[model samples]
Target: MKEKIIETSIELFDRKGFKETSVQEIVEAMGVTKGAFYYYFKSKEELLRDICLTYIEDLLQQQERILRDENKDCTTKLYEIVYMLIHNIRTRRKSARIFFREMRHLHEEHLQEIKAKRRAFRENYQKLIEEGIAEGEFKQTHTPHMVTFGILGITNWSYYWFNPDGEISEEKLAEIYVDLILNGIKNREGK
Candidate 1:
């Protein structure tokens, strides 16, 4: 029941935006009474917070697993993370959209918690870039801090229009994106 409510809310919130989505609308969509909603979630805001937490917590867990794998170096781990996020579009599009586009509605306290988890995600990527540099797999020309943001910007914004089923597969998209970042699009050794 709780999962159904959350799933319905995500679909509605994705289509109508969080501020526009009302408790009445959510309950109506779920064919349940407000009491049922109140039983699982204290308030609409609490439900939004749960949505935010669920999205970021799953990401952090997946990230931790990738970060822990000693078999893959920083570069490989970077690809895995990028592919992981892009691949999520197929399964978690609405939730991802909400987490990215609709999170401003969360209360200040809830906002802070989500922000911290988001920061951890960014910091972990930054650490991966730093590791790549230290291992001489990546160049020293760019700062990992900015590079991390650059890479993140690419992966994060991909949610807007990247089609995993399009001509470019998600795997290919990740490869191209990571490749572009690792190796600039410039034509070296110009004739």
Candidate 2:
């Protein structure tokens, strides 16, 4: 019952922005009474927070697996991380939209918790870039901090337009993005 509410709420929240989605609408969609919702979540915002936590927690677990792998190099891990994010968008599009677009609606305490987890993910990403640079696999031209944000900026923005079933597979997109990060678009002959 709790899971159903979360899933149904995600659908409604995805279609109708968080502010626009009402607790009434959530219960109505599930053919349950408000008491049922109140039983599981204190408020609509709490439900949103749960959705955010579920999404980020799942990502963090996947990231830990990739980050801790002994056989993969920084470059491969980087691609896998980016690919994981893109693949998640396909799998969790509603959760992705709510996590990114509707997070502003979360309350202060919940927002802080979410931010901390986000920082953890960012730190791991930065760690990868720093490792790549230290190992001479990536160029030393950019700061790992900014480079992490840059990679995130590029990949995160894909939720707005990326199509998993489009001509470009998620794997290809990851490769293309990693290539762009590793090798700039400017032609050598132009210089």
Candidate 3:
């Protein structure tokens, strides 16, 4: 019952912005009573916070697996990280949208926690870029923090318009991002 409400709420929140979605609408859409909703979540804000936390937690877990694995090189792990992000966006589009779009709706206290997790996630990627630079795999011209943020922005922003059902698969899309990040946008005269 709790899972159903959260899943339905995520769909509603994505379709209708968080501010536009009401407790009544959530319960009505799920055909659950107010008592049931309150039993699972204290308030709409709490539910929103749960949604945000769940996303950040899941992302961090996946990143940890990639980062902590010594078997993969920095470049391969970087590619896998981007691939996982793209796969998450495609497989969990509603959750992805709510995560990126409605996070600002969270209150200050919850916002701080969410921001901390976000920073940790970004830092993981930053460390990857720094490792690549250290290993001489990536160009040293750019700062790791800047490259991390750029990679994040490019990948996360795809949620706004990316259609997973389109011709391109997540792996291919990841390759495109990896290529862009490693090689950059400028055209080279020779291969």
Residue 141 error, candidate 1, Å: 1.6
* Tens-place lDDT digits, model 3, residues 1-191: 98899899999999999999999999999887999999989999999999999999999999999999999899999999999989987677888899999999999999999999999999999989889899988889998898988999999988888888899988999999999988887878866
lDDT of each: 0.92, 0.93, 0.92
User: What's the CA error at residue 85 for candidate 1, in Å?
Assistant: 0.7
35-90: candidate 2 lDDT, tens digit per residue? 99999998999999999999999999999999999999999999999999989878
Q: Give per-residue CA lDDT, model 1, range 1-191, as digits (tens).
A: 99999999999999999999999999999999999999999999999999999999999999889999999988899999999999988888889889999889888999999999999999999999899999999999899999999998999888889887889999999999999999989888785
Error of 3 at 127 (Å): 0.7
TM-score of 1: 0.97
Off by over 4 Å in 1: none
